[model samples]
Target: MSCSIKPVYGAQHPPLQVMPKGKEERSKTSNKRDAFQDFENNTSDAWDDGDDDLLVMANIQMSLRDVRSTAQAVMENHSKQLSAQNQQTSSVKDELRKLSWSGIPKPVRATAWKILSGYLPASLDRREPTLQRKRHEYFGFIEQYYDTRHQEIHQDTFRQQHLGLGTILKDIPRMTSLAHLFQQKVVQEIFERILYIWAIRHPASGYVQGINDLVTPFFVVFLSEFIDNDVESENFDLCQLPQETLNIIEADSFWCTSRLLDGIQDNYTFAQPGIQMKVNALKELIKRIDVPLYKHLEEHCVEFLQFSFRWMNNILMREIPLRCTIRLWDTYQAEQNGFADFHLYVCAAFLVRFTQDVLREQDFQGILMFLQNLPTHHWQNEEIGELLAEAYKLKFMFADAPNHLSKKK
Candidate 1:
């Protein structure tokens, strides 16, 4: 899939400006032109910040027939078997496994994730105390590990957030729309401290760019655990949140993310062997599934790593909207081998999606461009569901099917 869109470094997506009408449009036209000129020169503002993700909320079409029916199945089991709540864990676990394929409701998502990720204690009664103890340890570790690297963490975190506060505000509309509290320095420190410490502890795989993105989903989800209302609709003030709650959110996010990275530690370790293997695996898998697209890409001299690195690195976060990513993760979290194994199938599905268009691409540059900026601009809930189905089918058909995960790409 070659494109004639020209070579633009780091242009993750197309320009997001929605044209206005009449007099206001005319007045802003000149200003808009200047802005776009600056965009061309720098390309910093081209990063997809997720403001566009909000519109897809209305589009989620997860099958509710089974999912809705089993919505509170876990809660029901917990209440009914209160005396030996942990005893009925077998049935509850079975129910969670069945129900998670569709998606977990927001209210129960945090607890479900904890159970699935192996972060929760087997004794149900000990979860709260464990959470408190772990959170205390996390904050304590911050003083021990990050006390010396505070300035480095601050700079690294901000650079991760599109360079700086002023830059994040000026460039990424998504953060500004969320609230001003996100840009505060203390808020940044929480994330930086957690990531910095984790990298220090896990010397095998230090901090990676996409690891920062991985933290946000968990942070927001766990933070939702403390709040009762719908976090997406409400305008919750971060400043008003208690320091204790922030501590819990930060710590939980860290541990859950650590538990997550444990499975795919190779992805960030020593030259990122995990991604290299995945890219090779993806090319092999694609060749089996969509031979035409694979041949087309090969014809154009587009290497698998050219575009698949983003696919593997971001775990489809850069490709799909956040709403879809959370839903997708619900299923991914449910399976013990979901993120490390199932994610490859998701990458395959996402790759073959633009088969016809990609095949039509006549040059290597065009193919690389098309692969980078996948046509997911108008995707919604239904599209995500369909994509997952395709990924599932791929997994079903190809299990360790890519041939022992070839090391020599």
Candidate 2:
């Protein structure tokens, strides 16, 4: 899909001057002219922003019922798909065989696999050539032999070790300070614990740079929820027992994070294929809905992903404030039918709705910087939720379902 607007580069708007009204009919005529000019300016602004037409555009008719039904069915089918996906596992490979008999679409399953596999990168398995010791240095053998089965346990221990009963206790005061001591010692410590939670749980994917950014909101939210009033208290230990550490070692903390990370692995991939796919998808969606902004971006060589890379990778955590970023994360985590689609819709909504400031950029880099610096504009919660719902609604447009009619016939 492409924009309907003519290509305009660095276009300037003509200034309109309001004229004073004379008496009676003359005054009425002057007022009319002023009103017409104002209306024209408003129309132009709307077009420039790409918001006018789309604001009133009919939403993709997706109901909560539809999302629930689809998600439930997808989850049921996903169990089989996941079993198939994990077929290569030594003991649990049979899970895949069971799913092979299920009626789930292979392509849909494959998409899930693609997204899930990303969270567990090859780097997790291969030891680093350099001798940079990881946090799991304490449990040498378990770290060395880490696999999907013991991930959750590994993560719990990793959290206890790094985040520690002591550090977590100390870190509570820092949450409010948001200061240097807080950022450096406390925030960094907690971040390490969170990263290790991801890393140990995803020993297969291990610690990646961007992941810390991705999980920041989760940590922030979890801390707020779990810590509650005790966040300001001097003694707020998250881990209570050393026995818990042994239990973590046994329970597969690493595997759980791996499963969670699987959906978002593409974000951490160095090759950027996932990012490109998302940008292309957003561009396609925007072109159909808002031609002018699409054309403006294309004309300026401002590919959507250039700026979107960070947002897609970390879901705006790096760019936006914690308050907004966490809310978006909540929706993404809650909706998990591949949060990729929802992210794309939000990107489009921002581009179309915030067109004026975004389009003023002269070059790709400028456009990127503009997007990177994009503030939390005054948008309604309902509208953001609608954009998310629309993203899920649009999934069918991109996803291909398995053919059932041919077999039925």
Candidate 3:
């Protein structure tokens, strides 16, 4: 595997070619030019400011066109690669990983995510059948286990309560309330089913608080497939979509979220040992990479768990915007053990990105407060791409070093 990471920006485009025109075309072009010139002269002085505004608007439109074109080209390239004969081969996965490390284009993000998450087989012939089987299996689980949530016999002996429906219900409303799509009653009902079903199926961890936030990314991405407009900004009626379509989205979200949680299940297990170990690992990692920050944190009696617990438990979902989280997960799904392993490096990079602010804070309270409420509302793909690149660099540098995360003796 190549260690080189590609920059997200700076795609080169071919220049437009000039073709020779016939006499009739030349005459028509000349007449149009003359007419435009006459119009310009007639309105030049009166519409000077309007002309400037029009010029700006034209530039903005051209920029938007270029962006759409680039996104389309990227999506087409991913589709071709994913559809190749050896799509399931390691080489193809590696190429996809490399492409995804930068970012997955939104048009193909759902398919790319399904493939990368190992939910869908690479064989185009088998994909439909697999989806059908998996979707059916998921609904089967729903039928068998979903109704048991209301039964007193299904109550937990320790808590003397039913399944996690209470917690799930509470978290659903709080999760991504800013996005109109998630605010719909139908959307909330789907989320409730997916989370409740997943919790019942996974008995060990059950439903942890932050797990509710994890479902939003998968739900939104899969839901985007059926919607014509952007899921985040545009408000659409879930009633407009067929129940079958909603079922597929729900099942896909459950399976993909399951795939994600599988690698990091220990993070929510008894005592959350996985998260404790990972938070310690993050502390050790930052100590090595930025000794000054580490020592300063230590000197001020700042504990890693104070703020990082949320980071580790929620996978930084609470810290970054949902759009950025989705972009970050594109790379996460592409990487091996990405949620459990690569994410440590990502957290480190995220913390160090705020190094100056952290160091400038004279008190622990100020630093902790600043870290908790980060100014990430305006962040987009570009910022996320940069963060992932830095994380990849960190992984490349320290991943193989056994002592990199070891405690000082």
Q: What lDDT does the true structure give each of the candidates? A: 0.73, 0.49, 0.82
Worst 10 residues of 2 by lDDT: 113-122
Better of 1 and 3 by lDDT: 3
Candidate 2 vs 3: which has more TM-score:
3
**How many residue pairs collide in each prediction?**
5, 19, 0
Q: Write down the TM-score of every candidate.
A: 0.69, 0.46, 0.76
Candidate number that wins on lDDT, 2 or 3: 3
Residue-wise lDDT of candidate 2 within 250-284, one digit each (tens)?
22222323454677677555565777777766667
Cα error of candidate 1 at position 373, Å: 1.5
Q: Report the lDDT tens digits of candidate 3 across residue range 320-349.
A: 888889999988888888999999999999
Q: Alpha-carbon error at 133 in model 1, in Å? A: 1.9
Candidate 1 residue-wise lDDT, 187-243, digit = tens: 666777767778777756666667766776777788788765755522556666798
Report the error of model 2 at residue 276, Å: 2.4
Looking at model 3, residue 49 earns an lDDT score of: 49
